[model samples]
Target: MKQILQSLSSGITEIVEIPCPSVKSGHLLICTRSSLVSAGTERMLVEFAQANLLDKARQQPERVRLVLDKMRTDGVIPTLEAVQSKLDQPLPMGYANAGVVLDVGAGVEEFSVGDRIISNGSHAEVVCVPKNLCAKIPDPVTDEAAAFTVLGAIALQGIRLAQPTLGETFVVTGLGLIGLITVQLLQAQGCRVLGIDFDPKKLDLARKFGAQTVDLSRDEDPISAAASLSQGRGIDGVLITAATKSNEPVHQAAQMCRKRGRIVLVGVVGLELSRADFYEKELSFQVSCSYGPGRYDPAYEAEGQDYPLGFVRWTAQRNFEAVLDMLATGRLDVAPLISHRFPLEQAPAAYQLLNSSEPYLGIILEYPDPQQPNDLLNPTIQLEQEHTQTKAFPSESHTKAPIPHQPVLGFIGAGNYATRILIPAFKQTNATLKAVATTGGISGVYAGRKFGFGLATTDPDSLLNDPEINTLVIATRHDSHADYVCKALNAGKYVFVEKPLAIAPDQLDAIQSTYTSILNSGTSPLLMVGFNRRFAPQIQKIKALLANLKEAKAMIMTVNAGAIPPNHWTQDAAIGGGRIIGEACHFIDLLRFLADSPIVSVQTTSLGGVELREDKVSFTLSFADGSLGTVHYLANGHKSFPKERLEIFCAGRILQLDNFRKLKGYGFSGFNSMNLWRQDKGNTACAAAFINAIESGQAAPIPFEEFVEVTRVSFEIAEAARH
Candidate 1:
């Protein structure tokens, strides 16, 4: 469907034809009727995008420091490439949306098809939103007004934090869209509202909403006006809804508020506060999160888990419903708040208003009716102009073409790693990119177009059923790896899946059964796990150096895995199988490769008394050849340290590798050290090896036995650590 996308690298906004996203479990597919553009937030993003590199750095000093640290550790070129890739990602615009539900996904019982709803979905003809992020719109609310529900919830959330009461006087600093809405909501709570802004037009609107006005453009003194309005007493509370870098608004708000009164910040502003401004009054200050209680909670929003109404009172979705109810009862009128409207195709022109001097607020982008037939809503798009025919699922009797040894690639994911590393690596190997599929179609289309894929699709079955595709690359989430591998193998295709081939023992058993069946059919298609570290140049040198060793080797691998929030998807045991199985498996496979022997036994130990203790653990492996290796995966270390360090002690000699960039040997014949200008994690070499194996009909780059062995040991380590 047509969607508005902004380029952070070039600051360009355009309407692009994106494939309609497929509805996932607990999600609803909606056909948008209208969407509201957030002026303040989007304007800030556009300004940042338009600024020069130096200005951008100045705006985000923290990010600049991170970049400098990365350059120091990983070198300049790779750091710059990572930054460029991040900027190259297309950002979808608009969040406040009013739409009709086109379809309901599994487990979604709240809304049915044809239900009118409001959501924080982006500006697209079709949007797939989680049920918790969507609320049914009232019958009395029009689509245009319903588009303001999310914004109203933002305002109401701020008011909720302020805890305004009857006869209390409150000041809303910044009479923009949110500010005006906050003024109306506070007045609805029986509070006297005073609005402050530099714009006379906005102040007039605030006045129309029954709020006393203070126009900064007229050089009015807001503190004096508020003091007089409160009859020598300071105002009851103040809500700073202004977006600025100046600290004056907060200072003035502190002066205007009465003793022990509350101040809630619902917008961006400078935070350098004078100690006396808050110390004498013992005032309470809180920064309101967007929407409400469940704003950024993945379980609440993504997983459709709702907060108990009796305990939490109001959540982000509940706030949305409250705003819609107010709209139904005519308590919150948004008709006058809409300053402009534009069609979805003219979104670029609408964003232009943000940069222009033209006065605009609550700008709405309208979409085509769901009843209309729009070709843009197709689930698949042909990225290559010459690829005219789209192959459907072929029957078993379909004519089989002579299989060439060349690798024809179909990718199952277009995530950050796949787009920045895997796909580019395969592209350099001259692999024919057949198609790329993603649940959300944006990244698939982006990767397909950028890497010259013949087609981009939202369906994986399409890629698996295509006869021309000989190899399937699985870069999807950890939990989905085994399923994709089994399916690809059953389709008579070679498989190259990212690390940790299976998250569970049962999944490994299922994959083993599938592979055994495939082997019984007299064809052994290559099944390789993406243990790319073993392919690193330094690693290869270490492997060769260890090959001649007569004595047993002892290896130590220390990984500063870094801290990830407990709520991150990777930390979820069911999804990512914890860090040991998801990531530390790379070191397991690397050690296995260097030992050139099967892992016979494993032991694990983890930190105690922490929620995510498994992430900071040590695992030891005993190789059949008398080699022993210990992997210390610690997420508690500081970021400035080297991320990964590996040391080997064998035959009265020592070899060390640091962050895949440098290798040093001690007590060796002639080798002193080897270093590179940039870090190489063997991504390109890994892809090349896989492609070469396919072309030459050689064994899989890494044997399927080793893949299964490493994966099983990883699961064992994670289980032991958890216990």
Candidate 2:
């Protein structure tokens, strides 16, 4: 499948071949017919991407602040690399699409194979859209017209906020596509509408859509016209749909609206406001979110759980259906709104026109053979690369490795962590970089070239089943860890999987049974979970310093985890296994390693906060060796604070590690403070251990038993949190 991807580094859009995403449960696999390019929103992203580093920094000062914070804790070199890696990622473009359902996943009954539907899918040849974001198209609506459904929902949502009525007079600030759509929809409600824009062509379209035009290009003032058009009574409401950094739209909206009138913003603009302008009229201002209520809610869109109509009258999907019904009838005419059309292959030229002053309204990208299905849609597309440079290695104790004759590595997932940390670590070893695989072939291409992989592919199963690959690294999503581990164990390959191993008890049981069965069959492939913190040089030094002490140690570990949005996948238990299972396992494992004992028993409790819903929890670990450890993982901390702090005490001697970059020892004879130029979370040692295990035919650095223990403890903590 071919999809349009925008490079943030170069702001270049190219059609690249990638594996068609598999249809997941409650989702539809759609073959795209046409997709709409939202001019206002996409143009901003493109321009931002095209900007220089300094200009980009100027545009998003918040991110710059974050970079500074990272530098303070992680050091300058790591922070710069982090920023560059983020900028190098490919951002998928477009959201309004019309397509035929190629297949439907489990429990998706509303639409099935061959159903022509409109969705919030991107400009891809194939897309797996969640069922809630996918709406069935009416019989009379053409694909191009249906492609406007998602964008139409945006306009409808803004009007919904304005609360227009039959006898009301409303003004739409800006005659863009959304503004024009809002005009027609408001007119359909029997409201007198006036549209404002600097472009005469947009104003002309607004006039054709049954709106009174206020052309700023012709020096027509919207505020004066609104008062005149409303017979000196002032407009009932204003919908600001303009995209600019100027606050003029809101100022004019305030001036045009009557007393106690409503103002809804459906676009981006400078929000500098005068209190007096709004104070005298007591006007209401609201910024309509993307599409509608269910747009950013994970339970609603991702989980396909629709809000009941009795409780929430209009969801994003409901808004999409409403727009489609209007198009099916003659009430809404998007056919005339489309000013330009280009085939999907020439999407770059369409964007160029949108970026230029070429005067386009509803730009649509038509797909070739819209209803046809490719014979090999799910086949793995090998991402071939010409150069595979060996990465440079620093003079480090952990990274130095003996050259191996037959070590082959197949890595799954080429995401940020893998690209920035693990793969780079593995490249310093003697292991042959056999293959790199990811869901998207583009990322695989990038990772393969950068890490010197022999082959880059879209199929993890192919890499796993290959006899040439003796080792496999599973760095994919949390939900996928268990399955990949089981597969690798069954394939007789040494496995290094990132934590946490499993989310559910059944998954853990499956992994344990598979690993045990493989071991019983005289096949002992080393199994290691990515618990890298314990392998850190700072951590190792602490362990050796406390090696002779028999007294129990008391440790306190605080993780100022900051905030992950409630709608992020990390908060979704089914996807990311919640933060505790997905992330806190590292802390749990590190405590066990430092204590030199398994966690005998544990209890957990979470803090409650208003408005900020996150997992702010505390847990106590009672080790078998009589050591006690407490973990305080707080998400409400300020971004400027150092994220992690650990203090351990034994026999009144204290050891402190701050953010893994600096270590301080107190009440001890020969140690004051040990510092590093950059933070090392032991990624180098972690990767080297796994590669060295295969090379030396030795056991894993961290045993499989410890992996199971940490995974079990995490699950228990989550279970306790439920109460």
Candidate 3:
């Protein structure tokens, strides 16, 4: 379906086509007829996007800080790639839409196919929305009126925050669509309303909505005008619904509100308040969230869960229902709000109207016939021309088809692990990425195009079964890794599988035995496990530096491998094999590499008596060389802290690696030196080593025995901790 996306780097808006999303359980599928274009919200977004890089940074200092933090964590190269991918993604637009239910997903008992529904669906021909965001339209309401339901909810929520009772006087700042709606809703509650705005035309509209208009540009003082209208006592409450960065609106609201009165902010404006005015007045201040109760609660919004009416009278959905009721009872008429309407195909033109300052209000995009043919709603058709002209790379160019060269690679998962580590590393290698597969079609396409992959597919089997693909890099979900590896092996192609080889030890064992059998039969396929720390330059340097220390007694390895949240999918024993098996294996592999000897025994302990189902395990490995290595896999560290920290002690000399960014070597008699390493570019060195191994026809980079031993010890630690 057609969706609008903002480029992360440039923040430019673009329309793109993608697969029609399926309506899952607790979701509703709507074929959009009309959708409201939010002037206040969308204008800000467009202006932000059009700003220069420096201006964008200045506009959002908090977001810039977050980006900087991520860059520090993942390093420059990976962070840049992540930002570019995000920029290339197409986000869906428009939340207030009226449409027909094409279908009802299982567990959605509220509506059926052919029923008219209103929801926060996008400006697309078809949309799959969470059921809680959708409500059935009353027979008397037109589709255009229904499309305004979400906006009405926003206005009602602001009124609810003000809590204006009968005979109370309320002031609404800003005479925009929402401001006008707020005026009418307040009037319905028998409260006298005054609207303030710079635009005379908007003031005219507010006046039509039963509000006394106060033109801020013409009035000598808006506060005095409001106070004079209220018999010099000032208004009972104030609702600031203006959209601007200026603090004037909020200051004006404080001035207009009576002593002990309430002021609710429903607009995007700077809240730089005068402390003395607020302090002396003892006035109540509040910011109303979008819609009403349960706005940000995922259970209520996504799972069709609702709070009891007796306790929580107005939910987001209930707010939507209330707006429809007002429209049906002729209490709130939105006929004057309709200033312009465009077909879905002309959405770009609609945005252009705002940019060009064409006189318009409450612009609506109409998808008259949702079944019409449109390239922006269908990716297959959008890419049809390119697919037809492009030729597939020969199989020999990919693998062992009478050619001895770098292999052509295909990646099956481009998620966080792949984007942040695997793919960035792979970019430094000689291998060519032919295709990338992902469950998110838009992300997969963006990754492939951004990273210069030949193609992208949503189907794993399509890439695996293709003859032109020789080596498969399985970075997908843990449950599917073994199957992809097995398929690649059976296809006579090499495979590189990410950590935790399999969720179950049995599955790991089966793959190991299969590879063993294949090797014995003289038709072995190369298999590499992503134990990247072993290939990290800092870790390797520590190993080489410690090789000649004869006086080194016991080696104490302290690893601050930070924690994963309890709700993370990786914490699931059935799927991710818990953190120990999935992630701690990397630390275990590093310890083995450093020890340079077989581990003789293992022991473990955890902080909390509570453990993951597989348990959040930590291990102590005793090596044959009389060196002790400890792996601490704790789940209670701050996200901003250095993620992987290692300190090694041997014969009065200590070496510490701080999150792979800096290395320090401490010797006897206060002789110590620290060297800062250049930031890691994801796992480029590891990728280069793997490609070098493929080119040289070697038995992978890491020894097979070492891999097996590490896997065995990892499983053993997990089992011990689980009990």
Note the Cα lDDT for every prediction shown: 0.89, 0.86, 0.76
C-alpha RMSD values across all candidates:
2.8, 4.3, 5.3
The global Cα lDDT (0 to 1) of model 3 is: 0.76
- Where model 3 places Cα greater than 4 Å from the true spot, the runs are 22-25, 65-91, 102-106, 302-305, 308-310, 368-413, 427-434, 454-529, 546-586, 596-626, 631-643, 651-653, 664-677, 688-723
Q: Write the per-residue lDDT of candidate 1 for residues 51-168, one digit (tens) a residue.
A: 8788988999999988988887788999899988988888988889998898889999989998999999999988999999999998999999999999999999999999999999
Candidate 3 lDDT, tens digit per residue, 265-284?
99989988899768878888
Model 2 earns a TM-score of 0.93
- Per-residue lDDT tens digits of candidate 2, residues 230-344? 9999899999999999998999899998999999999999999989989999999999998898888878876889999999999999999999999999788888888899998
Off by over 4 Å in 2: 370-372, 390-405, 436-459, 603-614
Name the candidate that leads on TM-score: 1
**Pairs that clash in candidate 1:** none
- For each candidate, give its TM-score against the true structure: 0.97, 0.93, 0.80
How does candidate 3 fare on TM-score?
0.80
Scored against the true structure, residue 387 in model 3 reaches a CA lDDT of 38
